[model samples]
Target chain A: MGQTNPLRSARLGSRATDQFYEDLRQGAREGKPVCWILGALITTPMVTSLGIPWVFADALAAHLAARHQQKRPEEVAEEKGYLRETCSYTRIHMGCTLLSEEDRSKVLDWQVPNPDFVIITDGCCSEWVEWGDDVRKRFKVPIFTLHVPFLWNDKDRDEATNYVVGQLKEMNTFLEDTTRRKQDWIKLAEIINMGRQAQDMRAAGQQLCRNIPAPATIFDWATALGAVFNSWGKPQSVEIYKSMKQEMEERVARKEGAVVGEKYRLAWDGMIVWPEFGPLSKKLASRGANVVTSAYMWGFFPTLMDPTDPLKSIAWNMVDVWANRNLDWQINHVAQLCEDYKVDGLICHAHYTCRALCGQQLELMDAVSRRLDIPAIFIEADVGDESFYSEAQVDTRLQALLEMIDAKRKRRA
Target chain B: MKAVAGVDIGSLTAKTVLLDLQGQLLSYSIVAAGMVNRKAARKCLTQAIRKARLRTSDIGSIVSTGYGRSLVKFGDRNITEISCHARGAHWLMPHVRMVIDIGGQDSKVISVDSEGRVANFAMNDKCAAGTGRFLEVMSQALAVDLAAMGTLSLTSTNPAQVSSLCTVFAESEIISLAARGCPTVDIVAGLHEAIGRRVVSMVKGVGIHPPVMMSGGVAKNQGVVKVLSQLLKTDILVPPEPQIVGALGAAIFALEE
Candidate 1:
């Protein structure tokens, strides 16, 4: 099996480049082929589109190796190094995507004709690796390179224009140097227009979906898709929101049971399926406590967003409503859920890693508690990092709360 | 003399105090935050006014502080707990240059100037490690009322070391200690020690100054205070009803207004 080694070292006189090449050479000599080191900027959607069979890093390496075949090995290596240094997610994904001998052989041996042009597009955050790979796979063309820079909303338009112009100038320089072609000013202008068109399409799509209710689960997926596909069109957020509301209504209606033992209904809001969710639910069940509803699972409903016009939809949904836009709408939506469920208490889990989600937990808890007179408990936990959570501590708190609720019920009885 | 009322509705409790034009605390009341914060605030205010035997109309101004200050319907002014705690602690202890408040869901260290204003402060509102809530969880795990944790911790000979700083993990760690036949008192003492260490790190992060007054509900726990004092190598002062310091500060603000 002729294994194509994706790892390349160009003799560019830099010690770092030399060392990287030497490492690859050593691996090759040892019969361990290194293929596909993905940068963190590649997203799941990009991966799916690229028809890449391997993980993130491996797919990235393979994509780069195939796309930048005409370029010297050192240049590709430098790009990979630059990518790893900047993005942690890219680094993690790249590490995950590195391929073994059998996998490397499969990718290297696969034959596809090279295309006339390759266009690379990136959103604000790094997931551009997947998009680049997708274009490479589909067109079989070397990307001439396309980059979309992200800017803060408060950024001055004049400053942004200057920055974009500077980027285009740099790309022109790279094209001249790489292809040994003279600066074609007219073609350059056309290329800029194309980039703007792509950006506009995505922005338009996001705007159309701006009104979509954010479903907690499908947010990342919808946002990524919108950024790649729908920059110009109106976003599909409103439709998604309506669909989600319908689904939730049906689910709630179906779950509605006869008022049997206790009239008190408690709901846990915030991220769940965390370390203590199993134990917490079990404890509540043992006490004949019915957790009538939760925001954690329901928060991710897909109907809250439509990805038909993904870019505009994502941009609209990702907007921080509390500090920037009034979250009165979301507050009312949550309040309605509580009322419809006939909830008596709410447990607000303020997860540690999520700054945006955690910021509003206390305020929301206070508001809902006041509006409904339902006691709310704010349980703190780290969703992925279990080292921070104390199970015994949480259980004890929950037990005390249960006793308090029981006492309240008995007094009423 | 102008009379004013300041309400500091904290995460764990609601506090209200009455102040005269001269900045003297005429009367004060503390109440647990039940299901309804509005009712709790009204009740605390009524109780404090009753203690002074003054009419609500006599109050020239009303100021609110703490996390729950925004919810106070009758308050004329709302101030951050950070500023309120600094002002209140300065009034209570004139020489107090540093103030460490461990509330229900958050912890703060306020540095005051000679004139008694917030010079610089550091706060950890993101985690439960150094807050009063951590102790509450541990107390419940030990099957002890929150009030008894301080006294009970004093009796433990060999305190079990709680390694986890996270509240959820600390609970499991306690259960594991229990399984390993560790005494409940030792575990309780360990929890206090862990919390003290966390708080000490935070205070040290901000560079601690002497004459530090430990206020808030956690200040009531002598074990935590003792360990915190030892860790920082400084004497910690706890006022009667330390939880009301923010309210006291708000009342003082009302007096100045």
Candidate 2:
């Protein structure tokens, strides 16, 4: 059984997403209100049920960067005294807001829909706070921050759960005041149920990459993230994952991999350099080494939450963000991913200026290698800034890593 | 009578080496790398072949490494400098557990296992701070020859501190020091110390295990080597011609092939 590549599904999913953006843009233009939601905080089912169009600012930044137009906006942000060391995504978000409404019309390729207000989460990466502040200052937009607490094992689950529930109720009041629309409890329940099904199916698709000669690569998982986030509660999102999971299952039966001549399985940790994704993935695959898993790409797996109690479910999901976790938790999560994938090696990308991600990478690399008996390599580069990456240097490190893996295998044999 | 050849096309220079079946280096050449890497590679290879009194057809295998490896269309295969450097250092001194290579455009520290396989490695940021280009720029600023700066720096009693690891910022700092009539030798010593400090951290980052050897064009600078050895607190080994180690390793790979 030949595996069905999600190429068709990806195209359809992207088309649907594009249509959603266009619809939001048109609505915003006609004075129909919209909210700007951070993609990482997208409890899409709940937000959609609020009867307001919402755009994920990070997705729009990803969109512009994918189109190769991210640098100018970042430069614009930096010129305004935002530290260059800040997350490029945050800079890009600020840059999008800095564009004059008239200037934005010229580059209709990808624009953050005009926002009435911005809703985001606190207690995640501290960068979100700076990003939220910049938006509030520059765009004169009001920000509603859902403060999720960091859960230590010492704390009771109910404490965190009840706190998030309270915040969700506050969010309901904010939306009602901003949009002049009342909350519909019945509609919210249906959205939450759809979201639950969609999450389970997507998780199933992601888990299938663990098979030897994995059915799908990390790139596929990354590509499907937009659909998973944006199309949550839509039957189409569920259908996409259903087909993707079926294809992966067929590949598993055939012992097929996403790349030909699969010689080594690896997992990637840290944010991928978006600009180099195509070239880098091709280079890895050409060497018969495929990235079978990544903690970054598969974040936000569905946690059990009651569909009837939508606010509690959304609150619980918000607290589960990987970025908010302690270093020990992160290390264990990555170690578990390594064991789950049975990876031969780990590629720890030390992205430039990403204090949150790169701060602990040195420890993570050494720990994973020593604990798991898996060799790991550190690749230093910036995710959005092309100037920070040295292609030859990256190639040297990757080749050496692959050769080390080969040596380890030969030693075993 | 077959011989193997290795070509290393670095950012600043292209080098080539010819070796016999017994792994003895027969001949080698190092030349300035111009705008075109393919042309420079061909030039170095032809010169090295002629120096050995051998025809191109006499070479049985050809392997390439370094930044311009892909541009060598005639080569049989291209390998990365990390693997090549580790092999070369291991060939020279089998006990070398760490290799620090400071090239024209980049600096790196590679950790090697007992069998000469790369265990782990770390490279400098995408800037010319602890690299040959930094020295070249500073030498120009000081009105001193690149080769003589190293020897001159050894004479300094008290070196002026050059703190910035950034190439551009350090240049501005050097100009102001020069304006203050600071001795060229002292400033040059400071430059070496700055580079040594930067490279020492990188070595430690990869978990500094010694019997460490240094390679690449910058290895010829005794000022840097002396300061680096002092900073690392270990004797650093350098080959007769530091620039050709990558090429030598490429030849070693060709012989095995």
Candidate 3:
């Protein structure tokens, strides 16, 4: 199904103008606080700074929101319908939601829109957001926006750091000048410091686990410590980290039964479905495959990390740990998920234009296949660049893969 | 009467150079690679042979370099661009110590020893942001061809500031500038300055000394070369045909081997 522009005005020309006026009046009369549910990836920070109480939905929020949009069983048949509509990992989490409608509605309404002062800060492609103009209508506040580029090349670490710091400084100046209000630079500094600390703790944990026996338990402990440090002195962050850990543990313990007729459990790694996640998920389900786990979903686990020994962690993680641990962890984490999920195969989507993500696809696929003895099909696709993909070619290749999986299963049986 | 042929098939163009046994260039030919490596190599070879007024068998040995070096199936040997470039620069100016070859997809700073051998080298090939591709993309954004950029940039009395070093960000930066009614010349000069800064930093990272030679397609961009020379606080030597340096080096290598 084609996406009707979410922000498009219904009528063209003067009709749109009239509709906009009508919207403004309705918004004024209702006097509801403008609420913005910010996607929590990279975009969260910038949005949150705009005084929007960003909806703190992890991968689950995006998934649930996508499912809510797709209101029919047939809609679930096409992978592109749900999975390709949003980020796939988010869609999957949202699809797995056991929350009651009432509770979900409350969660959705968590933003207090009155006086329109809720901001969300999350990481996404650069930092950007889409919100209703109701807040602007009600409060007449300008939406301040700041976008960070998503490229990460540590080889150019000095240059990248200088660039980022410069952008941040410029953004700070813009915020102060535009709003005629001084930002809490202290808060920004604290968050940055905490982020760096958390990064360090996670690094240390990664190194400690590498040469040790009982690696998983050690890593988990290290991760939990890192999460605690990452969420340091922030009640909301602490609460979210606690919930995430509890949820992860519960999910692991419950070991949900395989869907009735599901034949293969697959794990996806890296970015997915910027615009077509809904359709992609439905397509996969039609093939009787379940993506039980993904790295993107699990990768956010470190966001919760906080450490007692931040300096120590940073030293170990940033200096002593393997230079590519950040990427390597994602790959290894996905491999671990495949094993834990008892997945039959893995599909590693190497998106074009995302050199950082795509760069590791070949190496990850090779490593995963060698370690697990599972057939890994590495597919190249763009997250949003539709021009690079051929649906027919992909479908043909997928069908052949499913057949190969079936033959392998039958032989095992 | 002996002559050697060198072919450097880069990502965007193919260059072939003919050198007499005395290491003097007899002739050279450069043409677009046209997205087909094999055909581009053949075209380059044919053009060079015709230009040199000699048949294919007249060449004693053929050496290939650049990204598409292996595509030259007719070549006697394939040498890495780094080695070939060093040799080529050495042949051009025996006193030259460092050779900076900035190609379309990759850039390198080659530190040469006294004997024209690669002593220490640094390369940035994983990203196109720091190469001639960045300039090409900027040219399109600025509505100019590769050739016109240098001359147009020279007209800028006060170049517009370009902050982003990343290719995508830099393009968007240019777009935003154009949207704000910034002049084309200023933007072009800004781009040249940015690229020059990037190249200078790369060279500085590997420790650049005097008598640095700049080669590759980007060497044709006088704007970048001017800014680069200013940044380095020294003169940069550009051969008569800068793009053919890699091929010239390869041919020199063929003779030595």
Top TM-score prediction, candidate number:
2
Candidate 2 structure quality by residue, lDDT tens digits, A7-29: 33545566667877877778778
Taking the tens digit of each residue's C-alpha lDDT, what string does model 1 give over B100-197? Answer: 98888878777776756664455563566757777777778768898998988999989998998688999899999999999888998898888887
Ranking by TM-score: 2, 1, 3
DockQ values, each candidate: 0.03, 0.66, 0.01
In angstroms, how far off is B30's CA in candidate 2? 1.1
Best by DockQ: 2
> TM-score of each candidate?
0.47, 0.94, 0.43
Q: Given candidate 2, what's the lDDT at residue A279?
A: 76
Interface RMSD of 2: 1.5
Every candidate's fraction of true contacts kept comes to 0.00, 0.70, 0.00
What is the alpha-carbon lDDT of model 2 when measured against the actual structure?
0.80
Q: Candidate 3 lDDT, tens digit per residue, A244-278?
A: 33443343355422232355666666656434554
Sorted by lDDT, highest first, which candidate order results? 2, 3, 1
Best by lDDT: 2
**Candidate 1, A1-413: lDDT as tens digits:** 11111101101112222233344445445543222322221222222222221223322232333232212222232345634222222322232233334543444322222223333334332344564464456445444343434334434434543544454455445444444456544433333333344344333322222221211111222212222222112123223333334433443344422112223456666654233433554455454455555543333211122334222222332232222223454456567767766665677766654454566666677677668765566566644334446553454334434534543464458
